[model samples]
Target: MSIKQFLDKILKNWPVKVTCFVMAVLIYFFHQISTIDKKTFVVPLEVKSEGAMVLSGGYERHRNVKIIVRARAEQLASVSEKDLRAYVDLSSQSSAGQHNFPVLLDLEERILLMDPLEITASPDSVPLSIEERDVKFVGIRPSVSGIPSHGYTLSKITSDPATVRVEGPRSVVSKITYMPTEEVSVQNATSDVTKKVSVLNRNSLISVGTGTFSVNARIVPQGMVKTFSDIPVSFDNLRDDLAVSGEPVFVDVIVEGELLDIEKLSADSVRGSVDCSFILTPGHYEVPVSVTVPLGLTVNSKSRETLSLDVVLKPEETLPDSSAVNDGEEKDAENTQPQEEMEAVPEDVTDIPQSDAVPEPQIQGV
Candidate 1:
């Protein structure tokens, strides 16, 4: 059959054609109505400021609004938080004060609005205090806690970015002088360490550009033992009448510290002593020796761990005896009695026995 003849045959029935056309129109309208939907969403209400300014003072909290949008069901199903944006324009508010503004909505092509969405904010209009935003560079201070392991000491603690930029409302930014990092612990740290530490947030209004910083700590081994000999040992709290003497008058002190500190030490820098305050009576004792050193130095061991002292009481004076004195005087008198002196004999002359005739021969020789 020819195309025109077939079309003429189909159009031959006017009432049937009108009914079919009306049915098709009704189906399209019903489909369109089925796809249309109304949904209520809670979205953040952001404020777009014209210049570098912030909302300060009275209202410190952020605001959110409830929006009812009319859109196709398929598009609404695929919609996300980012797709719906609500904001209050603050371009006209250039000075610091209170002001009321209208809320604006940004939507996509699929979204349709039958009527304005009703926002149940505490204040339907935006009421805020505007202030100039200020930024300042403040030093970051790190707080250290705990001690290092044995035989090790902390040498230095530092941060990579010593200072950070803080941007916030003028009042809050001016109040902040310095920023501080979270407390870092060096407990049981035997060697050098580096870590990332978060900066503490002192105030919510103030925002720090750098949230985290690097912290490094240096640990070094304590120097070798240094021995200082001949450190004079002294006694304390001894009685006046008692005398104390130790076997070793001096002691050897061993200390461990930094190399520079240990090198500056000498025998005279250390003092060793034993307390005798408890000894009321004189006797011998083995007392523990205590040593003292300069700052930045630690006492480890001593050559003479204990001191041995012989404490004795001074002797009392003896009383004079009357009979002994008299006997001494009589002896002295006997010794004073006259006595004959001995004469030397010549080498050539012969010695003769004492006799009365010898005395007469001596008178003849004279």
Candidate 2:
């Protein structure tokens, strides 16, 4: 049939032609609504900057900063939070000086204009330090085996710090001679423990990621730790009554839970402390301890441990009274007193160009 004939037949009834057009228009509208009923839009993510480029987002808000978006109920009911993802692209981050950036949404060609094209972030840019992390896993070789003095054995000598993380000028951490552990001079070490130990090689400028921040090695109790033969516990300050104690005194050390917990089987979770300045005192005392285990590591203490600290205390009765000293002797006493010194910071520091560069990943949140 010719085109004209077909048209004439279809349009023979003016009412029917008008009705058909109206029906087709209604179907189109219904189709649009149907899409709305099944699809959802992703909420846009805004990157806000403070004074610095909070590198890779931090804290709780920054970590999940990528917006949680979905289509209106029609399209989103079937989708899940797990199905959506907002990613910040670092490809354009050429040099990393605070720059407000957006994460692009790449849709599968079938979608249309139901979503907003872009959203802005706050603070805009953050102070960034683009530098390579001097990450090194230094092995802690405990020379003393962390065992106590005579007549005792370390049933188990695990370190609260199983691993030591060091970050500094790549060159520095790489050349490190050793990762040492502060002596835990216990007469007998049994069970597990959590102790806060300062990882030595102090360089305050160098930021330690707080993991195995200290070094510790388990002692098999092979033999007596020769290192303890002469570590005279200096009693610079002690009372007369508490002075004069025994050798290798077992110090009942109490520590917080969590530190001695290392769920990992076959590994010791022994913690340590560093204090050359811990003025040797008289009797056993429980002091606030600081532990530096691996960073981002949470502990579940299974066994509690104690510290057998053998110390030497000088009582007042054993020494001559100050009044008994002649003027000349007193002058000599003043000169004999040793002056105290200040502690320095850890030396190895990560070399990220601050202010002018993108921050090296804090990984604290990572």
Candidate 3:
């Protein structure tokens, strides 16, 4: 066809052609809108603080944000909360005060491939309190609960890291004197108990360099002291013919042991003895008093460490038969004269002269 004829034919439907083109563009835009899908996610919000500054006070460190993301249906299916990040930078905040920063979002490489992507967060900005960062070293205190086993007691508590470094706002860091660990149970424990425990961060504004510590609790038997009075001392290894005289020696003993063992002890339970094996002859001697107690008991002291006593040799004697002795006494009584009759004769003899009384008959025995 000729140029003049083609121009005429194209100009003839120009208005109609323009109307059809606008309608087609509208249809395509609506089709694309229908294919795009919106997904909402709850993602953690992070705060960035450069230099010597940090978020402080009631500000939440891991704040959750509700975000709506728009992309193709296939692309949105692969999108997850992990693929999105929201944060607010506090590095520009030079002074210590409350400041508002706009929350910015970042998408991962996979999510970035989706063309015509749209993202919007409910809270576009957040208010935060910025403060100068401070660090301090504080001792660690272990917290314990429950009791040890019966007849046992808690002795000492220790931690592996005696001290830890704490970092946070100047106000919060300065107020902390010591860090306390989570409660370590020693219930029914007989020996030493060691456990790994986390340090309790009571204040949300502070951060600890060491989050966990090893805590050791020492358990030992309960100890008590008891005094036993008047414990008699016995002599040991004495000769058969030797004996102890002048009253048995008694001593008071002080003993230490477990509470249960000490409670069951008495004066009779303890024995004190003096060695007499070395003493050959009987005489006064100073000897040490040795005491013996139960296996778990320890002797603290004795009222008398050494006692003075007398040792003597046993006396020997022989007795006559009782029946023979009694018979002989009875015969002597029969042959004896009355005292009154003898006295009467004596009076008569007294009247005679001493020379005549002396001339009495003398009998000689065979």
Candidate 4:
């Protein structure tokens, strides 16, 4: 056919021909898509900051992302969430305010081999607040719970590395006053309790330099106070000739010790006394009261700090009068002489009258 005739034949029924060709392309495309499969995955969204910038609050909602991939069945079987990485780059961001960043994806070499694959994410971009990085040193407070064993009490609690350094966004780091450690239980503990616990950070944006700390709890016996009343005060190191002349001194003693030890104490067990050895002569004086208690007990207080008493000499025995003894001896001698003279004339004077005989020997009787 001539060139003009050939061109005319090609142009013949151009509308119908174009329509048929479009139908065929559509049919082929539908047929190819029928064999493809789709899959969904949830993955963590990483943030990359090459400079001193970070994502502040409201970023936790965007921490994870949902990814959708379309590929042939065989290709989709080899794909997994681990093979893909999603992140937002904040390397160039330095301002301190809210910011919106586009989500980026990185596919591994093996996943990239999936030919004719389609991939898309649910959220193409996320909104985040970017702020300047900050660092602060905060004290660590240990958390303790539960009571100790019976007859025991918690004495003190201590933590090693009492302070730690925290680094995060300026806005979040500035609000934190102190860090708290995980709880440690001392239930039914007889002795000391020690543990290594983790530090808890309520804010997701904040990062701690040290993740863990050492905690030590001291447990000891419970203390109690016992009041011993009516303890009599005694004289210690006093001379035998000297005596304390005053009302009987008594004191009320207060002692403190462990519960078990204090329970065994009584009024009689506590002794109070005063030192009288310092007084050389007998006189009125104020002596300090000294108390003695059982071993392992502490004296808390005393009712009387000092005792006022009068020290005096003891009374002596009375003796007989010397003049009376001399008079008796002289009268006895005079009676003895008269009795001897009467005895010599007694036989011859027997005939005399009774009154006359007595008058003759009327000497003084001793």
Q: Each model's C-alpha lDDT?
A: 0.76, 0.42, 0.87, 0.87
lDDT of candidate model 4 versus the reference: 0.87
Q: TM per model?
A: 0.49, 0.28, 0.66, 0.77
Q: Give the per-residue lDDT digits (tens) of candidate 4, residues 283-353.
A: 99999999998899989999999888799997777999999999999999998998898777545544756
lDDT of 1: 0.76
Query: Which structure is stronger by TM-score: 3 or 4?
Result: 4
For model 2 the TM-score comes to: 0.28
Ten residues in sequence with the least summed lDDT for candidate 4: 345-354
Candidate 2 C-alpha error for residue 217, in Å: 5.9
- In order of listing, the candidates' clash counts read 0, 52, 0, 0
Candidate 3 per-residue C-alpha lDDT over 284-329 given as tens digits, one digit per residue, 9 for 90 to 100: 9999999999998999999998878788989987888999999999
In Å, residue 309's CA in model 4 sits off its true spot by 1.4
Residue-by-residue lDDT tens digits, candidate 1, 250-286? 8888898877578778878899988888777888888
